[model samples]
Target: MTRAKLFSGILISICFGLFLSACSNGESESKDTKKEEVRTATDAMGEVTIPANAERILAPNMEDSLLALGITPPAQWAIGTTVHNYLQPQLKDVPTIEWDLPLEQTINAKPDIIIFGSPGSIQNGKYEEYKKIAPTYVFKEEESADWRKQLQVMGEIAGKEKEAKAVLEDYDAKTKEQAAELKTAIGDETAAILWVIGKQYYLFENSRFAANVLYTDLGVTQPEMIKALPKAEAAWNPISLEALSDLDADHIFLASLPNEPGLASLKASSVWKGLPAVKAGKIYEMEDPSNWTSNGPIANNITMDQIVSVITKK
Candidate 1:
């Protein structure tokens, strides 16, 4: 009878151990489910529920805005054969997908949230499909082009509003400090920016892109040629080569798209060679094509650093 009792006790102890093991596994699963609980985000398309503290993020087209917000996505969107070279060091090994991401590709990446520069394009034919895969957010039409507003909305969605505001404030302080230094370095010297795309020559107007960096941040004087034109409604617009002569600023900032042979052709034009900035060796060739045309707080910081390096070295 005693031997029988000992065997029964051993069997009961084994069952208890198994029960405890099962309960521990159940608790772990409960914690994981809690971590993945859905949260709400409102965008142009209305409210969408996404995984809280999204472990993986994918922005097919607006990687610039995300990077500017200090959020590095799992992958960046690629346009044709081009990627953002200016952000190379930060995104060195990050993978890329087509601008209009394929459903299968996006699914395989397993993004908890997806963002787009413009997801409302019917022609893209993937907006709804993307929504099916993950909680997608699209910037409003008016705010899409404005980087400041983009950052604000992005911060709201990512729970980084305070960090975003701090970034902007820091940028403002840096700009003010740089402007003062630049004033002492080169007082009242006017500057102009020229971008060449294919056969077209474009001059940046007041209050955007490089102009925002040059005139607003660095406090560089705008050439009368740019001032005479109306405020910039678009980022860039076509200007005749004859118009290039009107940009008689003391310093000229020049840049062109990658693999663009137009800079050579523009220089070959007697009109370009005869410009005052060129003749006086005051023309500066901007190295990074990415930030020179786009506007974002981080891009603006890079713009300031590049220009200051050149001017201070001189």
Candidate 2:
């Protein structure tokens, strides 16, 4: 009878062990499910649920903020064959999808979420089609316009709000330090940013894109011509040669492609040649215009460094 009792006790102990193992496995699965659960966020498209821990994100044109937050998108934004060259250093291996986000390509990318730069980026009636592939979040005009706000929104969507705050804090600190240095180096000298593409001459207004870094952040004085111009309605706001001739900047950062016809025209024109900045030989020609034309901490930092280098010759 004692021997029989011993055998029964051993069997009971084995069953208990099996039960605990099953319970542990169940708990692990529950934890994993919680990790992958969806949460709602209010965007330009209203409240939408997105994965709490998205493994693959696709944000077109908004790659600057995503990259600043240390997230490499599965697909980069492109216009035809053109991609943002400045971001290629980090996104060299990522595939390109059209700016409009094609249906077949969206399905193939298999993104956990799609963050459009602006509501306008959602072309045609394709919002529903994209929703079928993944949760789509569209940034409002205000959120999309300011890099800092865009970065924070990206963090909230990706469950990294703390990280976004840290990035902004660091950026603010850098801007303060660099702005002080620029003030000391250049004093109150005014500057203007001119981007030449083909035959167009687009001037950067006070708050446009990276101009905020120049006029607002770094405390550089805006030229009378730039100040007098109306707020930019488009990304590339062009100025007539007649208006450009009135530019009164001490320094001009001229961005253009090598051998661009616009540069030739500006050089040949007596009016352009007579500008104060050109006559003083203060025009700094930039072959690569990516950083100046775009916004975000990464792009703006590169821009600040270039500005400091050129102005200070350091």
Candidate 3:
């Protein structure tokens, strides 16, 4: 072959090789894109087949759990204009979703997976319909009040089990340190949480909200009045002043939402003044009720700080 002809032939071969290499890479990239692992997650309702790469997750009432995992979901739980207000700064831009989850609205959000805080949150037997829209998981009712179990399930759904475990381990370490400091400061002095809404009064049980941080995580002792009560329900149970006076706790953390009826009158009552915590001037009125009301990882941490600061200062 002539030199020029040989050179042209070599150029064509080079171009053809380049084209084949491109095709091979395209195929490999496409295969990698198609790789999606599936996982089986069991909850109170049943087992759900979920994608390991699920994005656009909707945890509704479990926004606290998702926040704990460092994931801001597409939507958080809403009741009209209210939600977990303590999480507002982190969730400010995220949209609020309804508890009822109107079919049209839920479909519009295009969630890849939906998680409920508890089975009771699945109103009108909408679990099957929700499954049609996306993989749905409903936790047991008990998990609603537990931050640890809530985060574990959230990590499982997000395929971030390692991240979740790390978050929990960190929280445990901090809780232990705080608990030790609190034990040293308090020295067996007991505490109690009281909430007044409308005309009714409530004594927070050991397991709910910030009380959990005080009693369970921090090992703070609950007054005999609190320990003797029947196991508390998920919601705050009501009690009368006569019953409340039985609590001789050294410290009282009184929580009340803004403008809640009868609170002013209750505070003015002689019965309230006669309580041991009040007489000793150990009553701490909470300025922001969210610390005690919103039960989540973040809230618990804040609650721990608040408890330690107030108790140690006094």
TM-score of each model, paired residue for residue: 0.82, 0.93, 0.88
Q: Residue 219 lDDT in model 1?
A: 79
lDDT of 1 by residue, 1-314 (tens): 69999999999999999999999999999998886687776667787777667657787656666777778888876777677777778888888776667677788878878877654642356678888888887777667777778778777777778987987888888988899888988899898888887878878887767788899778799888989988788445789887677778888888776556778778888888888888999878885667887777767888899888777774
lDDT score for candidate 3 against the true structure: 0.83
- Clash pairs of candidate 1? none
| Model 1 residue-pair collision total | 0
- Clashing pairs in model 3? none
Predicted model with the maximum lDDT: 2
Per-residue error for 314 in candidate 1, Å, reads 6.3
Off by over 4 Å in 2: 3-7, 10-14, 17-32
Worst 10 residues of 2 by lDDT: 232-241
Residues 1-314, candidate 3, lDDT per residue (tens digit)? 99999999999999999999999999999887766566787888777788788878888877777878778888778889978777889999988888789877788888988878787888898888999998887888766557787787778789889988998898899999999999999888999988887888888877777888889899998888888887767555688877776878999998887687767877888888988889999988776777688777788888888889988994
Ranking of predictions according to TM-score:
2, 3, 1
**Local accuracy of candidate 2 as per-residue lDDT tens digits, 194-269:** 9888888888889887798898889899978888888877655578777788889999998787778888988889
Error of 2 at 273 (Å): 1.3
